[model samples]
Target: MNDIDAWVWWLVGAAALGIPLVVTAMPEFGMFAVGAVAAAIAASVGGGAVVQVLTFVIVSVALIAVVRPIAARHRTQRPQLATGVDALKGRQAVVLERVDGSGGRIKLAGEVWSARSLDTGHAYEVGQEVDVVEIEGATAIVM
Candidate 1:
């Protein structure tokens, strides 16, 4: 083939490859449509018009079929959790010492942790069962 024919063929192949890559990488940029147009233009100018058109159609359809669902799924958001002490809420623990208005120790999920009671009026003795209502810095709020 001559240089012009080679350029046309190169354009055709580049469009075919670039279309899928752009669609997969940046679907929001609308590069797939641009690639499809380039492919069609290349097919008309280059030889093997029938084969080029068929290949372009097949690849464009395949890319659309594959990328749409993946893009939709990726746009979804996940729930967030509070950091630090708030993360330990709803945990069951056993008091290691008498927990009153002041600080004490507790065992939670096989790990010893510092604990305190929200109600200073109540007293919790050793081996008493409690639930972690909230977390405050390095301490657990127990009841």
Candidate 2:
């Protein structure tokens, strides 16, 4: 144990931290692994245990501070290039069959889809155009 280099220990710690980062797909663990790598660099430069530990802590904290807010901002960002299902909302579709609350079919996005009226009392006749209000499961709710 005494013969093992301090840098080797730091590298081992970095590898250990990397396992969770890969398994969990969490960015924080990767940050910690980066910190461990920094600590390994410090140890290679003859930094004592205290210096290595401080390097790890400071690097880890700095990375967390920077990455977390960017992650949060990314998470809060609005729709980017809506897909077919999301784009279906508020778009017009022609009723292929009598669409009531009980369920029917519609031609939406060049495809046939199961649909129902958003309002139970209202129904759209075949060939009538309706706006898709929402998609619930495999069904489109229209009005």
Model 2 compared with the native: what TM-score? Answer: 0.76
Give, for candidate 2, the lowest lDDT window spanning 10 residues. Answer: 78-87
**lDDT digits (tens) for residues 9-38 of candidate 1:** 646556665666666776633445544555
- Looking at model 2, the pairs that clash are none
* Leading candidate by lDDT: 2
Model 2 agreement with the true structure over 8-101: per-residue lDDT tens digits: 9889999999999999999999999999999999999999999999999999999999998999899999778888678888889999999999
**Candidate 1 worst ten-residue window by lDDT:** 28-37
- Superposing all C-alpha atoms, what RMSD in Å does each candidate have to the true structure? 7.0, 2.8
Report the Cα lDDT for candidate 1.
Answer: 0.72
TM-score of 1: 0.45
